[model samples]
Target: MTINRHCPTCRSRQDFRKLNDDEKAWVRAEGSRSYVDNLWRCTAVGCLTYFRIGRINDRGLLPEKFKKEPPADAERP
Candidate 1:
């Protein structure tokens, strides 16, 4: 079932659902933690963007050894 969640691209609350297996695999291929995270995708027409509501990257709650660092050449916004 879909739930109401904020869609960053839509800039509004929208319907969202859990990622399917194919979607999860794709996310995993992209090296995203969201594949195993409490991730959701906007279901609004033409807006299938993804977002996460989990603590997968909450460093404060994680051990130092598990913390991840972006690649040196990765650009920061």
Candidate 2:
């Protein structure tokens, strides 16, 4: 499972780091194949948003609830 180290709030690709080894392992255990409860913190200037990184399945992660739905125009003939 690959975790993204980018800040979801600011969308910054730098200055963001993963949690400690122990924490990561714990998160993996708690999450399922469809979702991994990984955590990340942004350290760019004033941006201090803590976010959860997880696997993207038909539905999104635990905290961020997302459901996939087809486009409205897909049924057009």
Instruction: Name the lDDT of candidate 2.
Output: 0.44
lDDT of 1 by residue, 3-71 (tens): 886666678988877767766666676664633456676666556466565532321121232223556
* Deviation (Å) of 10 in candidate 2: 1.8
lDDT value, residue 4 of candidate 2: 43
Native-to-model Cα distance after best TM-score fit, residue 52 in candidate 2, in Å: 2.0
Cα RMSD, each candidate: 11.7, 13.2
Q: What TM-score would every model get versus the actual structure?
A: 0.60, 0.32
Alpha carbon lDDT of residue 70, candidate 2?
50
- Candidate 2 lDDT over residue span 1-77, tens digit each: 33345556556564544545554554466564323345554445445344454421222222221222456797688
Whole-model lDDT, candidate 1? Answer: 0.58
Once fitted onto the true fold, the runs of candidate 1 whose alpha carbons sit more than 4 angstroms away are 34-37, 54-77
Instruction: Candidate 1: give the clashing pairs.
Output: none
Tell me how far the alpha carbon of residue 63 in candidate 1 is from the true structure, in angstroms, after superposition: 32
Overall lDDT per candidate, in order of appearance: 0.58, 0.44
Predicted structure with the largest TM-score when compared to the true one: 1
